[model samples]
Target: MHAKLTTGAMLLAMSTLLLPAAAAPDWQMVAKTFGKSGTETPDGVYRIGLPRTDLKVSLDGVALKPGFALGGWIAFEPMGNQAMVMGDIVLTQDEVNPVMKKLEESGIEITALHNHLLRAEPMTLYMHVFGQGDPVTLATALHAGLALSKTPMENAAKPQASAQQIELDTAAVDQAIGHKGKANGGVYQFSIPRAETITDSGMQVPASMGSAIAINFQRTGAGKAAITGDFVLIASEVNPDEQPRLFFMHFWANDDAVKLGRGLKAALDKMDLKNS
Candidate 1:
């Protein structure tokens, strides 16, 4: 009995020593247009920038506007024993492709490259990025990508897009989702409830996070059915609800799935998916 007890104690001590500590990734250098007015949260890293109106928007002074939007992202998991970085870029529409191509060449991955608004002059593109290894290394990669962008590191010089009521056929969206939805930018938005039995990371997912399905539509054809945007979902075995609001915005129906999967997976692991 004494021998067995001694062996068990030794095993317990060995197990305790093998446990890993909570990770704290070091962000070494960030070379962004605004020089880092962005905020880094437990959830992710976010940068805010105001593009030059003269180039991105066609407008004059008195109408000048300071673009103040947040680009939130973070690193979640470790890879092959290294830290993985993941995040998104929420900037004016035109900045998307440039950022995507640059990041790709620099060994960064872009999962979903799309928009969040409608009729915003110059448009806006939301790019989701993912990577692995050192935090600073990933940040540096982003810096290089942003460096190639035409976006003005400063604020907007004029009011390019107005916040008017966008027209949308709410009835149609509701019909598709089998529920009622509200109007957001002249377009109808619908939310579908996920099956209650589903949960992510052993946590109960709220109706707002991953539970409430969001559907945005645009009128592409004559006056009939409009082409709906990609239906964002938790594709990986990791339920998106595990990180609540920390899921990559994939360009699902738009191709580029294989190219996007690798980086997006890395980003998801790095992000602290808490809030829905």
Candidate 2:
């Protein structure tokens, strides 16, 4: 069975279940204009996966899976005559500036530029963008910017397109982590949502649109796993000065599955400390 892709994309196309009885935008047209298809999440947000399969990155000794850390994605939430888009653009060191320039030229706001992992063969940077406008226009501009890089425009390799075997004990991972996980192209992913509502520019943004705590696990060896994801943090919990309101973290371990689960639990506890 193919993994239900909510935390991933290259294939953000159609809504799996029928949308609500209320009238909705022509998502099929939007998906076509974007040059890729996608799926709609439970929260009514539409997501497109753009995993950077072009990059062969390894953390420590384990090769990183595209869904683990290289998952590039764009999400759309409809708003009457317009829509809001948010996404992460994966770029190598050289592709950063040109892509940023292109995105800016098209009026998309570059919300962030940072690294998710520590040290890898070739370093990677992430660009976060936000915009609200016509769905087709936004897709056109976003596609133009992605054209500058090697990010695949085709959906043949999207996480949801195929059913890759997952050997890890994902059931144990779900129990230890306190939430069920979804498998996408052999990667086990968890999108942990918070208790409070999150809004951007006066509109509510759901956890599916990059607001939730994301934890991804991919098997590297026998009882050994490689994990990486972003922890959405609030500034008030800490000093709240100089620190951005949110924090994204990456963790890697090649030792044992038990130890990996323990460490991940500890990290989640700490990150969710204030909320709990």
Candidate 3:
């Protein structure tokens, strides 16, 4: 009788351990873990911006603002019992390995690491991260990884009146790019998604998950601006012939860069499917 009672009690405890959490994750506690509040989109994605305001970076003789270029962010989307998290971490040359090591130790996947700019003073590297697990646990792990670097954990201050607005000729930029852009924290941003589906590791990838072209323009001075963004290319459009077209983009585009790029993409999409 005593043995049976002990066995039943053990089974109950094990079942309790295997069960999922009784309630949803404490988002406020997650924010407390990272020392930053976040906003939730209508689709239930909670995103926290971790701009590298501590870094003083400049490009093409124009100073870069956190909202303009150093805007690091981490987002969490609830996925059943767990959560899927994705983010871009902006780190200096020296802080990359240490922070990456910490993130790896915490079970975060470092998807890609590269630069988003050229000829910028005090170069910075971007570390793209993805993970799926308990929400609070994931946030804690991310906080630990960031703590390995000199990333600031203090509450961000309110933006100044001038810094809150963009000073660029936005209409001219739209006409030249052929894509309308929206203002985001003083930075004008545009996103051009691929017409076809994009897959990674045999799974369909969405545009929100770094599968689209993103362009950002930040006003450096009156009538002057600095631009930076990513070009998401399909597999067939990645040959040597297409390399120079993207790498050496600044030299061209005196006229309509977007139309030229769109035409090129369309051509490539219709390329000889037999050979390509």
Candidate 4:
């Protein structure tokens, strides 16, 4: 009896050790599972987990930037089984080139460089960076790069907007993507299929199992075109250096050049997908 009790205690302790401290966040698998040639989803179909990044910054605390914009960048499919990144970047200022040079010197790839905003800030710039391995480490490197900027904290604010208001445009946007988009309070999003010819992470998604690009748009007014707002996309497999550049360029600098990115991302986060 004593031996059995001791064994049971050890097993109990082992089980306790194995348990995760908290429930892991359900990170939706946004990537497509493409199969071989001859079978693929339609072209221009977007996918999820294309490995992307978003950085939102503010100046003067006046909320100059938008939240959750994709920064118009994406990670390329891995090469020969290795990670490859591809995407675009829009810079805020002309001086941003020096920052890009610094990043490249630290082993990052600049896929593209440009501007999404017309005019703003101490002249912000966006750099599309690509690389592989250790997401957190990449984040660390990104944090390092951001130190070069004068933007303020990327603070997290409480969500605004309600679910009922979000449902207003669900049907309309859904029609564009060929499916019903989810309505979560203030946020409405739709993820559509990607062409089967597109493959990522050694996974072959059938035409039926294509990729998904989620768009979160907000409704600013009650009129027909009232839903005018920004759109957010999730690109999987994005590296760290690229993440910072994209975050600031695509999301943080939304003064007209960013379109509806700010309001769209904000509204989407307030939504409840299950309710939609």
Candidate number of the best TM-score: 2
Tens-digit lDDT track of model 2 for 197-240: 99999999999899999999889888878888888877575666
1 against 4, candidate with superior lDDT = 1
Better of 1 and 2 by TM-score: 2
lDDT of each: 0.51, 0.85, 0.80, 0.42
Clash totals in order: 23, 10, 0, 42
Compose the digit string of candidate 1's lDDT tens values, residues 1-276: 344558888899999999998556443333332245443433343333333333332121112122221223333333333445555565555666677788899898876666554554555566777676565677677777866765445432333344323344556656766788654333444656666454444433343332445565443335543433334455564455664445334444455878678767787788667765
TM-score to true structure, per model: 0.41, 0.75, 0.71, 0.41
Tell me the tens digit of each residue's lDDT in model 3 across 36-151.
78877555667788888899998877888777778888887766646778889999999998999998999999988888888777998899998888988899899999988777
How does residue 183 of candidate 4 score in lDDT? Answer: 53
Q: 179 in model 2: Cα distance from truth in Å?
A: 1.0
Candidate 3: list runs displaced more than 4 Å.
Answer: 1-25, 158-161, 195-208, 239-276
Root mean square deviation (Cα) for candidate 4: 19.0
Candidate 3 Cα RMSD after full superposition onto the native fold (Å) = 12.3
In the order shown, the candidates' Cα RMSDs to the true structure are 13.4, 16.8, 12.3, 19.0
- The reply for model 4, stretches above 4 Å from the true place, is 1-91, 116-126, 134-136, 150-167, 175-177, 183-187, 197-216, 220-222, 226-276
User: Looking at candidate 4, what is the lDDT of residue 1?
Assistant: 44
Model 4: per-residue Cα lDDT over 81-183, one tens digit each: 2333333343445436565776576666665565434333443455656655433333334334434543332322335555235536566667865778665
